[model samples]
Target: MSIDRVVEQIRTSVFSYKKLADRLAERPSERVRAMIYLKEIAAEYNLGTIEKFKNLLSFTLVKLYDDIDFSLPTGLDLERIVKENNVVFVPNHQSHADYLILSYVLFDRFKFIPLIAGGINLNIFPIGDLFRKSGCFFIRRSFNNNILYKLTLEAYISHLLSSGHAIEFFYEGGRSRSGRLLPPKYGMFQILIETHSQLDPAVRRPLLFIPISIVHEIVPEQGALTRELEGL
Candidate 1:
């Protein structure tokens, strides 16, 4: 059998098993069902369980993007970066393909990198749902005053980092409405610091911050971003 056939079979079997398990487990909500399915697959694969689902998702993403002509930078030591340290990948946001591109570069080359994404109304769709199941937690975009929500997010992020998962996120809050790199938002940084502070000194791990810059010579949304930035 071809590799493509094998991969498709795996995907089908996993999804089918997940559906059956969700039904048996009495998970009534779609969101919850999806979450359960992810956890089950993660466990079955022995890839670190649900707690490490983000890494598994990153692996899947890299495979998906490899079908394209995506390639990683040369002479960069990906293994040492991903395997040896708790990494926080901060990339400049540009295209909608940022997630797939980065995931492909990291996983296809280095192996595993877990990514986090903002959960907003706009992210609710088939692709969004796929990301969430693959291990992306949603963050509320406008929860400016929601202290409880902020704390919960912080805690979850801390938990993941402390457990040795490599994290990837866009530091520029949202995608650049302009072609230029927007000033970095300190929310994610602040949360990382706070989480670091709370870690028991004896059990703490070194966190490595990696900044990735992606430059597209010709942006597809240049016109749209220019218009949006002008209005701002």
Candidate 2:
């Protein structure tokens, strides 16, 4: 589905209805402002750009690493699973390249590209535009105090799941600096759980989470990681 349709669905969602109505009744300006904010935060998944970027990403990967090995756990039955359920992939964080490798391999092998959750820190000028077009959604690193931003993000993600889009995020929140698995971040999981509970059970499809572990022989950010560890 197009992003416009997804945004419409979110705008008219049950959650949005009450909030929008309440805002309209209390303050007209606030209502309009809320809608504009939502529009800005929603992301588009451009298939054509994603396909083209994969070739460039692959070339870059070849130049950086000796080799990348991809394998699925036995009896995973990925094709059937994707057909029946909305999929969420939670992979371990290792290096910045973890996301690029995963996205490329999935597109190449299964033609299934997932909308990845990326931090707003990486949302720079040219690179940010490229990433957003290639199915990356920018998110604030800390939004504990921003209720509106939180709700909008939740609605956007909920719309994506209802429309049958796969999602990918690092459970560790950020790349591991120690070359070891970090503690899981519960933020995305909490939003997903609440979203599932809000759906009509009769019509809600199963949401499945698949864990992925990528092993890197030589992390691309090793030098940076060492420096940061030393408080440089």
Candidate 3:
């Protein structure tokens, strides 16, 4: 049997097991709860086990090209970073593939590194659900001016960082419309530092800032940026 077929069989078996477990018990155990969560996420995202298998397969394809020379380092020291301190993996955003690239590198090569991603906008189709289930939380991009909401968001981020979660975010708030490095936005970083300061010294883990430099021979979005720049 092919690898894809094997993955499909595993997913189907798991789903069947979850259904049986749910029917047999009044209240599910933690393991069952976790399975239910995954099932819900997959269903909401319109992702069957087959779709997720495809995403992983896509990740594999990207990995094949991960080592292509770009005059900069591609491999991240995620294990070392996670072992020693709390980290925010800040990388320059260039392609839509950035998240998958980083995720594959960290998870496949270095083991499980949990990352918190900025949630996709609600208007986006099925993919948004996929991203959310894939470990992203929503943030209101336009609510930067709302003080209460901003503080709440910061607090949540602080809580995540303080708990030693390996977080990843683009320093450039959004994808650069222009294919150039934009200035770093410190909103997330500031929250992390402020939260760190409030924690007792003995309990606080030092926050490590690891800058990921992604160099591509060609910017995938160069055409869009060029058109905008030329006022075309």
Candidate 4:
């Protein structure tokens, strides 16, 4: 599928006014304000510019960082497994560049990309919109006891798996800015684990969990991390 088509699909898959409104209706008292907030956000999100954003972001990131590379095996038979099973990529989070690097690799090697979950706060301006079109579905961190929100997210994830789409999420939720390997937060990973039973019985034997780690000899964000840690 073309990037524009896929991006449009991803955009609607997450932000549907009808669906969100219906979900918000579950909590009658909160519907009015929630709808107002949703309306504003819905306007803020745009799919038209996203296609250009993806092409530019990938090209720009790849060109700017010459030292980036991966540790994936040279002759591992991942393609056959990828065809037979729904794979879940569990990668260590280290830098903001991680997703850009991974997307670049997938784009170059496989010619296909996977949709993943991200926070809605990243749905803001230029960079955030760039990320959205790059196959990310934005979500809120705190669900606020909103059952509708939780169920919607779970349903969306389930749909992606049942359709044989490869899934990915940071095993630690986000980067360990302190420069430490974090204890697995199990945030987005829990969705797959929880809904394992709901997957198609015939092809659900092994949900391939590909554990990948991308590293850099000199982290470009080291200084920024240190300053943030020091409460700058």
Top-TM-score structure, candidate number: 2
Q: TM-score, each model? A: 0.64, 0.87, 0.64, 0.73
What's the lDDT for all of these models?
0.58, 0.78, 0.57, 0.63
Better candidate number, 1 or 3, judged by lDDT = 1
Kindly list the per-residue Cα lDDT of model 3 for residues 44-152, writing each as its tens digit: 1122433463467566766555554322346755566587787777888887766666665555456554554564353156766556555555565555665434444
Model 4 TM-score on a 0 to 1 scale: 0.73
Error of 4 at 151 (Å): 0.6
Looking at candidate 2, the ten consecutive residues that score lowest on lDDT are 14-23
Worst 10-residue lDDT window for candidate 4 reads 36-45
C-alpha-based local distance difference test score of model 4: 0.63
Ranking by lDDT: 2, 4, 1, 3
lDDT of candidate 4 over 1-232, digit per residue (tens): 3434543454454434344546655666754554333322321223454445556766787666765565558887666767777788887877777776786677557765666666677777876656655666677777748665565566566657666777778788777755567788665777677665666576464677899877666566777998988899
lDDT of 1 by residue, 1-232 (tens): 3223433444433333332334534644443443332332221112333335445656765554444454447876767766677778888887666665666455555666465554454345665545554445566666568543454455455556556677777898877745689888888888787776766566467888888777766555777877877895
Task: Please write out the lDDT profile of model 2 over residues 28-74, one tens digit for every residue.
Answer: 56656556556656666778888889989878878898788889878
Reference-based TM-score, model 3: 0.64
Error of 4 at 101 (Å): 0.4
At residue 85, candidate 3 shows an lDDT of 88
Task: Rank the candidate models, highest TM-score first.
Answer: 2, 4, 3, 1
